[model samples]
Target: MTLEISRLLELTTWRVFDVADDGRVLAGCDESGSVQLVELAEGGCTELTALAGAVVGRYLPGERAVVVQHDSDGDERGQLSLLRLDDRRSRPAPLSELEPLVRDSEHVHRLLDVLPGRIVYATNRRNGVDFDVVIRSVTTGEEHVVHDGGGMVAEVAISPDSRFAAITVPATKPLSDQVLVADTMPETGADQLRELTDRDLAARHLHPGWQPGGLVVTTDAGRDRTGVARLDPRTGGHHWLVTSDEHDLSGRLSPNGRTLLVLTAVDGAHRAALHEAATGEHVVDIALPSGGWCGYPLPEPVWSPDSRFAALSFSSPSTPGDVLLVDTATGTCTPLTSSAAQLAEETLVEPTVHRVPARDGEQIPCFRYAPAAPDGSAVLLIHGGPESQSVRSFHPLVQAMVSRGHTVLVPNVRGSTGYGKRWYSADDARNRLESVQDLADLHRWLPSVGLDPSRAALWGGSYGGYMVLAGLAFQPELWAAGVDVVGISSLVTFLENTAPYRRAHREREYGSLIADADFLREASPLNRASAIAAPLFVLHGANDPRVPLTEAEQIVEAVRANGVAYEFHVYPDEGHGLAKRANRLDAYPKALAFLSRHLG
Candidate 1:
């Protein structure tokens, strides 16, 4: 049963956004060849919004209307819209029923929390660089600015009484953040903002939610690994609620504040459990798929109003993304949505986790997917976000390559999360190339793991794409070919041309342009393009806000000057990555064909 690459690419994926009291679910699915919003009920899945790119949403208190955030093309400037729901009618409603809520095309807006009469969000409309957290009334459209202390606002939460708000903002260093609290009502003289955590510590705080006693957040401030803690708003002190030595811990509280859904990151996989919120007592460990992704994208484990049940999105190599319904009392997880499109789960390959030793005695964790019938070649797939980890998730490109008989190795180099704070900050600032050194070590160790060193190619997107180009340019003879999607060629040009809101945040990890210009130029692949002698394929979105299209154009021009074999493609409607299925179906197959010809 050999399936075509198109068939493998056709596999649909979904993400759960919110769950209603009556067991209805709000989700994002790619069944329409593009990511769109849909409502999951007993009758059937009904499309809610037909907007472009990807859409994320939540049920406004009553479940009669939903507040959705969507961006045009791939520009990343999100706009908020309200979709009026009438579940009584039965048939799917038209896309024209949406009402614009907060749409400012010049700036970015992100929805943080939704309540009965208002919604909390972070927007950079104030000055276009600093994000301000605002609570706006759903009926009157009145806005109340809570915290505007000048930094990228990550997460925000409203108190149970709707009087106080808590937010997480960047601290003095990279990968470190602090939580702040402020009154949501401007009429109250107590609206003055105050820090909720120690300002001198270098810890990263996230997932701020109000409990009866204090603010519940996950931080690694005074510890090596992240753990759940309760921060006292008045005293600026904290105490541990959930702590683990072997893994990073994060949790979300139920609406009633009685139960906490905690997720633990074990290497690249996840483990979930229910705990008593008051005493932090473990209730029951929920059984989950062996290798599946359950953490990330902010919203997961959306609980019902009564806190009896929760919905979480799960995905892995063999399973396409789907929402799972979890019962807290019995610890039962039932599938709520299916996007397999009639494909057999057994046909897909499952990866085996391994720890590859680096040259400096450091062990790098990776997932290897081996095809039943080998084509004598391999592809090293690198993940983006030197800050992000490559976990067990459904990747269309990885599956497509396996179906074509190519073994794939996905590694999490130093500076990737899910490990620990120490591991993630290893390659920061002056130590940038140390992460690239791990790539060289992996290339050398490939033969020991039943892979052909001479027939291997490099594949990645964004920062992963930068790794591909760096490997080819820095260690020219190691790879057969390289496929770079929206990769940075020159750190100097990247910092200069990237979106203003993202520049400072990215510079903290990749070194500053003003202080480390010479080092940045020397590390750029575009500086040594002549060193690349292998065939290459470069793909980028013309509207990419993070890494501009100039990145692709300059690299292509440099490689062309050296007479290197290469293919360059630019998607006018795409940004950082391919968000549309039609574009992915077209781009990935060509890239695979290029790898096939070069590897042969």
Candidate 2:
């Protein structure tokens, strides 16, 4: 069952991020950036090979021909390449030779902000936690460090005037991340600096992006409704743009400082609302399907450079997500990218949005996928992000099941964000039971909506996979069969037994092992093994860093011990999700066989 070291290494690395510039949708083959260039009119995608891991420079407007990319996956020892779009005409940019100062450096995150003359990025070595913000110049090619040390920096906002840049810093030290504030652009000397926390701020803030006068910060009042605060970095002065004790406010400050957009279920449901930054008056609201992503829904709502149109999308469970263009000027909406249009209309299943009330009366949002009535059997599709929201996106997987005559249900449980901060906060610490109840309530409702509950299947990945095991043991009668992909069987053991390096984030997201011992034990699926009541299929990668390989082994052992109907699959050469084409190809068939036998 153990994989040789070489085979495991092959699966860990990927080869084809580089494609020819023909520009069709390209497959994401590896940690190296993958991109798909599609010809909209014809639906033909030309792939530009030789492109790096990320689509770097925006091509000439309207050229639409090729994409240029950079391979950022290369660390200090890996191949650091800056590849151009489909050709060797342009010179390749040399990725820094610096050894990766951090693992998933993108996790602690190495962000690079490019202004006309200056560039800023984080210098982090692989497998290391400590980080520093470093800056380089485009015109002159000079490099320097901005921050001395790091804790998890994100939302790197470069001020328009380029006179200063704003960054949000939070470290583990006492009073370190307590009051949110802004730091100035670093100069050659560390001695010359400005810190804005002295200005007096309230609440532990997040998502600190720049506005006209200062940076906008989102905060909750002692774990309640979130409010918006704008601080003038220069003067250490502040203003509360909008405050609500009941409905949490979500703000996305547009690129230009003139318009500030706020959202909170404006459509009788959570929807996107625009506001004037200076007056704090509501400007306009965009409608969304009831119970969808709360803020800037219809898509991420990209404000055109001129601030004229808000480009986004609105999606539901049954319906494939559609890209949209909203006119910020006239409030007109247009569907630009319709993934559903690619499919035949008669075969389309409509997604109904509703939240199942849990034991605590908390509404966990769920998308119910209803197929035609001839076949009432359906599958419950749970999303992984105990911290993520299940929004309307084009999921080829969901569509495939629908094509095979199966209904799919996706639930954004207690841990999901965008239902306001409270919904996400409710899932913290010892609230794992609430999340489990959220799924139970959702499943209990399936039979009422034409689905034959006795014939349903439980399928999920990551946290969703964790929910699968929890479902079988906690609520066995809900499904006939179940599928789990890279799920943690026990929180207590996962914290104590997994890779020491990844435990840092695992502790922060789930709960600290030492501090929340009792809760971790209760949250583990392994603790309730005898309760499993359905056939199960568990799949995991042999070299996964986050969940590690042992989680699957331990849980599978328990499944075997109880003599439950189960099958265990570990992709030896693949880590996390399958990266090798053959391994991924092999998984589809194995899943088909397992589901057919169990769901039948």
lDDT, candidate 2, equals: 0.56
Most accurate candidate by TM-score: 1
Counted clashes in each candidate structure: 0, 37
Off by over 4 Å in 1: 88-95, 296-299
Best by lDDT: 1
Q: Which tens-of-lDDT digit does each residue in 351-457 have in candidate 1?
A: 88889999888999988888888776889898888888887777767877887778899899988899889899898888878888888888888888777899999
Poorest lDDT segment (10 consecutive residues) of candidate 2: 12-21
lDDT of each: 0.84, 0.56
TM-score of 1: 0.96
Tens digits of lDDT, candidate 2, 1-600: 211222222221111211112322222222222322222213422333333333332222123222222333222111211223343333323334222222243433343444444446654453355456656553365766555544445445666665455655552321123333323443544333466654233234655557656777665634456667777776545578876766667676766776765666422235566788776788777664433532222223345444565544455433344444556666665554444443443344546677666666666677766545436666788777676666654344565566555678777777676565666756666777777777678777776776777778888887888888888878876768888888888888777765554455457667787888887887788888777778888888875666766888888888788888888888765555554445545665566567767666
TM-score of each: 0.96, 0.73
Clashing pairs in 1: none
